[model samples]
Target: MKGISYARYGGPEVLEYGELPDPKVGPDAVLVKVRAAAVNPVDWKCREGHLDGILDAVFPVVPGWDVSGVVVQPGVSVTEFTAGDEVIGYVREDFLSRGTFAEYVAAPVRTLARKPRNLSFEEAAGLPLVGLTAYQVLVKALQVKRGETVLVHAAAGGVGSVAVQLARHFGARVIGTASEGNHDFVRGLGCEPVEYGDGLAERVRGLAPEGVDAVFDTVGGEALKISADLLAPEGRLASIADGDVVGYGGRYYWVRPDAEDLLRLTELAEEGVVSVHLSQTFPLERAADAHRLNQEGRTRGKIVVTVEWEVEPAG
Candidate 1:
């Protein structure tokens, strides 16, 4: 199978496109013919050795997590899906040994979910990691209730775009920070768009007047440091982008793939309660280009790598 791999941690230039042996599935796993895979900051972060301490990689590591595909084969013990089923999932971090930047990848049946019927392969590919992160933060970590107000930083980025929409779906009046160009876009997600940088607090205050009930900070820098002041008394704050979140009195959520959550997101997508917006896509061989665009941090939504031959026939 053809895939992209890096022998060592470095820049995008280090990635190479080549052939590798096909993956072998375990009794509880399924072999996915990857149709499209999404890129996250973590992909490049691992590429550049930023996650060296937390995640050790073997040489020639395949780097991708979010995937949407068709099941080409199912493990002996897998009962949830068959060879032609459409699925989406976050391949385990431990399995970076064989990542989604390949023609095929194997995942535990427990990590995979039926892809949303309403989404295309490219759009479904954009949902797993970012969608799960947003769902966990709002529904699990912060327990945001209806009629409250929440603020999301970096609202135009991959995770932020989904987070803003999900928060609003849960009945929170959402305020999101983005550049002027994405103001109308964020507003379309039912959020009040706040221009980020320089007096963000004042701008938010001018819009809400009563302050926000929670803060979801995807741009963790000085913004994370100042986020506490924007919250109402005892309000929660969750940062999915790992940074120094020590004093914020809220949890730092590192995303993990939960089949249950992915299933729920699928239901939401099918119901038109939430949507996945794919900003761009590259062929599997051009994994370097996908990483380069994501690392630039200007993407309005998810960037995906499409493995064209793996796409399933339309239902």
Candidate 2:
């Protein structure tokens, strides 16, 4: 099968499209014929060898995590799904496994859930990593409550878009930071849009006189430190980006995937409480171009790769 693989870490140019042997399915895994795969900042970070100490990658790694596909073969122990079931999931990052960039991938059954009935493969492909990250930060770590006011940085990006919607669904009023161009877009997601950069804290203060109940920082840097000051006393703060640790009074969190959290996000999508926004799609062979676009960091939402394949009818 043709897939994107990198034998060494460097720039996006290092990624190449080529042939690789099909993955062997395990007893608790399912072999999926990938329909679409989404790009995350983590993909590039991994590609550049940024996660060296924390995540050891196998040479010639396929770099993607979120995937939407149909199950072509189920493991002997898997009873929840059969061949031809449409599913979406976050492949484990630990092994640096061959991922969704390929025409096919083997995922642990527990990592996947039935794709939302209302979504297309491109849409479902954008949800797993970003959706789960947002869900976990708001519902699990911060425990955002109804009537609370929450602040989200980089509100127009993939995870930020989902975070804004989920916070509003939980009854919390949301304030999101994006450029002026996306103000209307963020507002449409039930958030008050603020311009990000210097004086961001002042802009937020103008909106919430009493201070925000929680802060979800997706653009970690000076923004993370500034977000801490925006927090109300006893407020919650979580960062999904790297180097976000700060001595904030609120809880500090880094997003990690749990099968349970993915299940919750799946339910939210199925119920129409959350929506996935896919901004762009590229063919599997253009993985390099996909990475370059994501590195630019200006996309409105998720970027995905479509793998050509035949979909069996749902039984």
Candidate 3:
């Protein structure tokens, strides 16, 4: 099998692409022949040792969590899916040795969900992490309701883009912050677009004279601070990027692998209620280049790395 791996903590330069042994399927796992994998900031962050204290990293680590693929083998205990089932997974294991940026991944059954029929492999690949992040923040963490006004930081981004649409589906009025250039794109996703940076708080005030009902902060740091300040008296706040949010009466969340939550996202995609926006894609060999693009931090939507393989017909 071909995949990307790094022997040590570093930047994209540490990534090497070549043949490696295929992953092993466990009693509760399914081996997926990856059709596509999505790159998130955490991929590089983990590679550079930023997540070392939190996640156990086995050097020569394959790095990625989001995958849309076909199940080629199922574990003895797995009955939720079978060989040839098309699935999507946020395949985060307890350790970082084996990952989705490969031709195959042994994904635990708890992390696998049927891929949305309306999405191509490339699109489905982008949804697991970001879609789950958005869904968790809005529906689980914030509990946003109909008729509420919510503010989403970095609204045109991977998680934020999906969050914007989900907020609308929940019947919340959304105000999303993006650059002036992506304002229209944000608007098309059902958000009242507001330009990010310096005067963000004042601009948000202009949109909602009263504070917003909730704030979903994807871009952290000062944006998290701003989100804390802009919330209504009873407003909820959650940040996926900033742990500092805990100091501001807000919760910090890390996306967890849950097949049921992912299935909800699949339902939303099937209903045309939310869509994964693919901004760029690379062949599996150019994963280092994919990391470079994601590190630039200017992408409007998800960046995916695609794999091509022959799927044996279902018997």
Best by TM-score: 3
Q: Candidate 3 residues 118-218, lDDT tens each? A: 99999999999999999988988999999999999889999999999999999999999999999999999999999877898999999998999999988
Whole-model lDDT for model 3 versus the true structure?
A: 0.93
TM-score of each: 0.96, 0.95, 0.98
In candidate 2, which residue ranges exceed 4 Å CA deviation? Answer: 242-244, 250-252, 310-315
Report how far off residue 311 is in candidate 1 (Å).
9.0
lDDT of each: 0.88, 0.87, 0.93
At residue 106, what lDDT does model 2 achieve? 90
lDDT of 1 by residue, 1-315 (tens): 999999988999999999888999999999998989999999999999988888778878988888999999999999999998999998865534678889899888777899999899999999988899899888888899999999999888888889888988898999999999999988888888988788988998898776789999898887887787888887888887655665667788888878899999999999998888778889988899999999999899889999876335999
- Candidate 2 per-residue lDDT over residues 26-129, each given as its tens digit: 99999998999999998999899988878888888988999999999999998978998999998865767577899899998878988888889999999999
Candidate 1 stretches greater than 4 Å from native: 310-315
> TM-score-based ranking, best first?
3, 1, 2
